[model samples]
Target: MKQFLILAIIVLSIAQIVARPVEYSDGNDDVLAPEPEPTEIPIGKYLLFTTKANWIEATKQCRSKNMKLISILSEEDNDNVVKVIKAAGEGRIGFWTSGNRRKTNGVYFWGNEKKITYTNWEAGKPDNVRSNNGEEEQCIEIMGLNILKWNYRFCSNELYFICEEPHESIDETQPISLLFAQQILTVQMFGYYENNENEEVLTPEPEPEPLYDLVKKYHIFTTRVSWADAMRHCQSEGLQLVNILSKEDNDNVIQAIKDANQGEIGFWTSGSRTNNNGTYVWGNGQPLTFTDWENGVPDNLHAHTGYGQEECIELKGYHILKWNDHLCSYRLYYICEENTKQNLFSK
Candidate 1:
């Protein structure tokens, strides 16, 4: 009887072993790995700007430094400016602002038509006292007080100012293209409330510091690739083709693309030969010197010729099909190159 009980116990043990799935472990390795380095924003620096520049020189100063002149669009920003100034010393006071009345003396204007209607002006000031400083003191400036009220100064006077640093904010939540780094959505909600929907961007503004650590060089496509494929190739190299802005802007970009493509490639462009009204013009604001379109290319099937979508422009030659789309995505091998020109800030 005891032997039978022992046999029964052995049978139950075997059943349990068969029922439970085994989880083997070497006792050292972890299942999950750490995130990639680029995914980590190192504790390097915060993107912010604070200036103590006096009025006149500040404009050129920000420009030289590749920054927009400081814009005090909110109380928080105002406080930040004040803190920077106070941290410096008692002597440091006013800095250049986006305001100007030089063009129309006595009339006020913010650098981008930002309404100063909700501004914090000192009592009984902007009185147009007509100071004997010289010409009509057209530019605007900001000077501060120990209290909330700050004084407005002339723009021509020299002062130091602050520039905000750029921050990389990737919305991992969004479906937007992940091709490029995402900048913060700098919605000027408060600035808009004060009728300041725009910054002084129409006028040429200063550029920001280099985003990448160094001027990463890339090869222009020696063989033409479609725009989609070109984008993928650039992604592999960590760069993109030169997006030309004007006729002169094409010079350096084209030179770089040519060097990379080895005279056998083309590029896609952001423009078409035909405009909305059907005028065929170079995206770089110049008339074409040559044409090479498979002989009968530009079929213009849609017939929306003037600035039409089908009317695309490509760099003809060397088998490289660098092309741009009427829809910003028509595939082609147009231009391929990379550059890092400093002092060229984005507006």
Candidate 2:
């Protein structure tokens, strides 16, 4: 019996070895597609606010911001983008890159071009899920920089978002608080004769206020108003504070109110962090997205692993003064801003 078993084991091993095929060429090791040649993008005048938006939403959001989706050029460009995202300094993290694979199968293609070359996917990513009926997945997402991983999710998941604009576009008439330039209020150089032997240098028009600051500019904050009360005040005047997005967004709010109020006290913002799952959803009912959390904060009780659990909140007065978690009924002096988009930046 022992001899027979040994002979059988050897036969099985030989059969297994014979069944496997070895490729003649080592070329299989050279799998990744070459990175593509990048376009000569203008000095980026605009730094897009990243969003977790799927393809459709991303496109729409970027357009609303008077911009478009980012287009990746080379691998080095990807690396630089990662650097800018990290340097943003908001505890809240992640930024949309110019890469997405929602169109071609398992291919990371640029939104604005063709000729895909470079690839920066995490290990075993772009699995490209297939259904029993033979449906193919076309959407992909990248998260975390240290080891950026791409995953296939529904096209409508409303993840983060990315915006793109020519560097020259930023110098256009945007608001100051939105983009910080010491000379934000200074005169424009374009078409202006500084040292020209012509007309005197006209006071450069101030860049338009950032969307958030502009919104707040048209708003008025009252003291110790309940959430409902605040909402009512805004509604009465055809205003609503339901669209805050980034930390810069929240900060913009505080800054507007503070500057407008002068010695006024702290008020409640329409933004909020969740006490459940630590998923920060803003007043728009969209997730309170963005990597803008100040460190050691938004603790969300630290119960949901590292992510916290506070949602539906208001920013503190003095412009994004660290946020707080309070019952909405606590009757805090709250803020109410008007949205002119649904109305022209009106009160």
User: Alpha carbon lDDT of residue 46, candidate 1?
Assistant: 16
Residue-level lDDT tens digits of model 1 in 143-216? 54444344555443445444443223322121111001111111111211122765432231233122121132
- Badly placed stretches (over 4 Å) of model 2 are 1-98, 101-122, 127-218, 235-238, 242-245, 271-281, 286-321, 330-332, 337-347
Best by lDDT: 2
Best by TM-score: 2
For every model shown, the clashing-pair count is 52, 41
Candidate 2 Cα deviation (angstroms), residue 77? 14
Per-candidate TM vs. native? 0.30, 0.35
- Candidate 2 per-residue lDDT, tens place, 272-295, comes to 543335455555555544534444
List the RMSD of every prediction in angstroms: 23.2, 19.3
